[model samples]
Target: MLDANLKTQLQGYLTRLQQPIELVAALDDGAKSAEVRELLDEIVALSDKITLREDPTGSARKPSFVVQRVGQPMGIRFAGIPLGHEFTSLVLALLQAGGHPPKVDADVIEQIKALPGKYAFEVFISLSCHNCPDVVQALNLMAVLNPNVSTTMIDGALFQNEVEDRQIMGVPAVYLNGELFGQGRMTIEEIIAKLDTGAAARDAEKISAKEAFDVLVVGGGPAGSAAAIYAARKGIRTGVLAERFGGQVMDTLGIENFISVKATEGPKLAMALEEHVKEYGVDIMNLQRASALVPVDGGIEVKLENGAVVKSKTVVLATGARWRNMNVPGEAEFRTKGVAYCPHCDGPLFRGKRVAVIGGGNSGVEAAIDLAGIVAHVTLLEFDSQLRADAVLQKKLRSLPNVDIIVSAQTTEVTGTDKVNGLKYKDRVSGEEKRIELEGIFVQIGLVPNTDWLKGTVNLSPRGEIEVDAKGQTSLPGVFAAGDCTTVPYKQIIIAMGEGSKASLSAFDHLIRTSAA
Candidate 1:
């Protein structure tokens, strides 16, 4: 049943429809069918532009719903009730059916249209997975725009047998033309890049810089974008080089900690970041990786992996960081098999099954708490004497009956022949070994900075973080650092952005002094 507030919100959303939408619910003698019918009824009552009809041909195994405009089929179907985070997917599909094109660029649309063959996408999803909506929306838009493409959204819980048959261990597990496409949340460009052969290399052109810039930002994450904006504001030539924009933020699920905004997802925030940076006169170089940095007489020569070279008077390193692995036996062997890093993407695959979470930091603890509701049992292991999560999160975890926390424990192995079946751990103080039988494992220890390319070119901490000062200045002059790649105490979106602005301003200060001298 829809709550009063939710009903009001749905009504408001549907009132903005540009065209009438028709929902066809296929039902059978099943509990889910009746539930879906009732929900559609409620939704249909919200606005005059929406209507619903029922079909009794659906089987008990998979009752489906098809969304269309007036009498035109949109080729968008849902094999199960689109509840939880998937509600957003249904809303977007309806909007697309109402004649609204996707928010993608025209060039991207043309690229997708240029594909030669027909493609079918089957996207597996969990209701609670925040990342699934983006994947589903991107594919749905593709299906809507192209005549040769079709898309379906499958609820992982309702169709457990199919999920197990496919060995699907993650939400947003996309299947293209009956074969595994990819998993997790990805941009529209990324999806098309995989389908279009030679697309990756062809779509990305070599970045060429003819003249030097006063400031060159090394990454396009929050910090680098902020730095680029600030540097460009100084009325000087500024450029940004990114292997891929958005960095670690692209991996985030829901972001509530970022100040000002009440709530936003990783991909959405990343889009906004790119758009905000584009607002300035900064030279944004995408899909370009900095392989080496050489300090020149008055500036640094940045060498890209594509062999392109660019000169800059100053540089800001915001290369960002990646997830740290357990490094234990079978951990790497079972990656995406039964081991996963993203809790939102793979948590549902382990529903009603046992799983273990490695590390007891904020990320690990949060993963345990989030997974506890989806998985049958959660065993959290920490190498330290106590949990490092916030007190509030720790309290919430304690209240969950299906969660177990072990401190001063060391993970020895992720045991499995084909898929993860169990984990071996050691009690550091008691010198006792223990084994916990589980179907999946989630590791969230920490992040390793992406500063391998900057090795020896600039001073780095023993931990591989770029060494920076109070003003975001690195060990070398005319160089600065920000975000997770730097020696900053805390790594947060707001903090990185603040540091980025500081570093850009510092670069401008250096240029001003140099010009005067």
Candidate 2:
């Protein structure tokens, strides 16, 4: 249900529509369709400028709806129930169809208009992806502004077959004109460049896998870049492949713990990292994702998803990890607004405000203690009956005057309007649901390694992390693992960089010893 103030505000915005918009819902007789219909009915009833046309001719395969103005298709379509974070997508579509233009840069709009050919942008996204909305909204805006373009927003969860067909493991996996474009967060300018050049399209000379290297580094994160620089300095034929340089660090809002650098944003740091790596003689393969790694004669072979392969005498796995999400309601909706993952990156933003930290692990306790010094209050919520953090960390957390710890508390939902205002949690013992008012929620629930591709090629821990020795040596002789993807005790950027350096040096040592043999 819409709040009185919010509904009134929306009505004011809707009343100013330049034209009448029609919502043609292609729905079958199902619960999903019924739910969507009810939502649409409420929206259409808000203003006479909008109308709803229900069509029971929807394919049973997938439920969808279309928006049109003056009988002209705006190329805006929704394949699933636009709930949570996706609710914004629905509102933007309606507004665009009502003759309201998107708030994109004028220069970017001109660039989109000047695009050579018609581009069908199929942006596959997950509701929980914090970065997907921006991409989706940008592409949808391009479609609205240019009749030569069309856009479709596909919910990956609902369309599992398409996700499998495309082999999309990350969110915001975009495809342009039936070819895999790219994934993750990208600016409008970057998207335009990719669109103009058909960035993924390669020539035989570019993607023909005839090249071999002494050392190959997969991933372009802090660890991978460090490895490439170190290996290149050894005067070896080193190469690095990445879907996008910067990796998880690119998503970080602010980085203050990277040594020497007092404060910096993720994109700035990513650019600096790429520039530094480029200073070396390393062969860089940008926008490439390794799909498989196998042993070859006297070396290892790496196969990319784009049908490119490269053989290397030694390999360094620097693929980083992603933060584990809460996967609860309102969590995704307030992402980047009030729900954050990296405490060091986003904790300062909540200064002098009450915040909650989820999980009872070391990460969560550490975040709560760190935040206690800055924020007005810190509430630590743990799902387990007992805290799993180290004794020292638990002691420090308990000593904090502004920190309150709660055990056996399950976070059910993140509640807010525009921004996070509160959270809902259930007590495991008492079986009572309670609401806590807080401005922000930090999710410190461990990490998931990006080493799923190297599952059989290397030995993995029961926790799914790649097992590595102190020398950064993996189960395989020629293959080394580093960074958060490996069994590194610490998951800091500096530690990952150091591990990457060790792996590269180890690879070089292997090379020298093998040649001597």
Candidate 3:
């Protein structure tokens, strides 16, 4: 008896609703309700047969519910959508639903209770930000709990122009009562205090760079480049912002799978795409981050991390995914020297040398295979008992003469003074420790989306994925988001490019409607 229509609408939602078994433990065939409640009962009943996969490498993978220091997963559930002050309400809702809420003081509770039921609120966020989704969820729940609250998600990638106009440099910034409030993690009590103290609000027109434009895209990966080209070709003013000229592809060493290209390097491919976009007069801004956005009478005002500003009618967010880090000691120090994250980038440097690939997934296996062809030895380490990649890929890996797959192996330490000389590892099954000599280490552990700067601004799925409609509409009226940041399966470059194009067209439609009106 579930609403198929609602289900269809939320089909793009990143993670599934993992119902708690305890919810029914106390029911005891007593509780009752209308058909709506019956639908909930039916839904809850079906959940009995469901369980989450421990690995996300498979199709239909459940998103990580929490961000962990070791890149594992966080498991929690909120039954409603996140928007505005309603995000804050999520905590109260969860508390009522039998979850522990972030601690709050009694005085802060009184201030929240004293509020009038008529106020406006907006929160902007990013998906890569580990803490932002919860912040957005908390704010949305608060909005739901309070009738006077209204919330909107202004994605940093999609609405760069708006961000630039607000002088923002971080995620989860709350603008309330005409002042700026807190930015990072905050409890309901903390936010309530800021609200009562008349802090965390801003005035319109304070931010400069008032130049108008048609479309602004954040990120410089395939999706960002695709959006820039599509928009520019259509005679729309287009611009791109990126930390570097190229995106993740720049770090990719080799890409033989991209259509029409037999062999390619990440940097080379990024350069080619960059050249093509530039030819179309797409304005490019490198090494810049969007900070904040303030809704105005005409359009939204954007702020940047560098204290710059821009105003635009519509915005497109394309900040694609980022490489997941191996939070080891020497990993960061020797990233390019001996400790490397990308096999394609540094594989050639280790020719005739022993190398370690610190993952057993597709990319890790693929990297080992690629390195096996160049290096004298390739060691593939996996924390699990078996590799979590396609059988075909595993077969290919096993066929390689120089590649060795080490199961249940976890990297305990990376030991190197300057360049990586070797790594210390632990055998999960035997509890033995050993040092493996290697010239290079490729950390294909995982990927974290580039959304850290987006907190306090947009709606993010529990796994730090941007929430978008079927057509890629973000939570904001004149904003849209797409690519890896969005909650979609298949994180391929082509798919990201396709999503970016879709979002650009969606943003254009809104632009046209606004212009027509």
Report the number of the highest-lDDT candidate. Answer: 1
**Whole-model Cα lDDT of every candidate shown, in order:** 0.86, 0.81, 0.62
Q: How does model 3 score by TM-score?
A: 0.55
* TM-score on alpha carbons, each prediction: 0.89, 0.56, 0.55
Please, what are the lDDT tens digits per residue for candidate 1 over residues 1-517? 7899989987887767888989887788789888888888998899898899876663334478878888777668888888788888888887788776677779789987887898888999988777788888888888778878888899988899999898888778899889999987776777887788675455344454358888999999999989999998888898999877898888888899899899998877988999988888688877678899999998999988767788899998899999998899999888887999998878878989999999888899999999999889999999999999999999999999999999999999999877889999999999999999999999999999999988888899999999899999988889999999999989999999999999999999999998899
| lDDT of each residue in 293-352, candidate 3, tens digit only | 555677666677656676777777778787787776777766545776655434544557
Best prediction by TM-score? 1
lDDT of 2 by residue, 244-362 (tens): 78888777655789899999867668878888998897787776778899898899988887677778999999889888888999998887557877665455456578999999998
Q: Candidate 3 regions off by >4 Å? A: 1-210, 260-265, 430-434
Better of 1 and 2 by TM-score: 1
Off by over 4 Å in 1: 4-21, 46-61, 70-72, 203-206, 209-214, 253-268, 281-288, 294-312, 395-400, 430-432, 515-517
| Candidate 2 root-mean-square deviation in Å | 13.4
The segments of candidate 2 whose C-alpha lies over 4 angstroms from its true place after superposition are 1-114, 117-184, 187-198, 203-205, 327-357, 360-380, 384-405, 412-426, 431-442
| lDDT, model 3, position 9 | 37
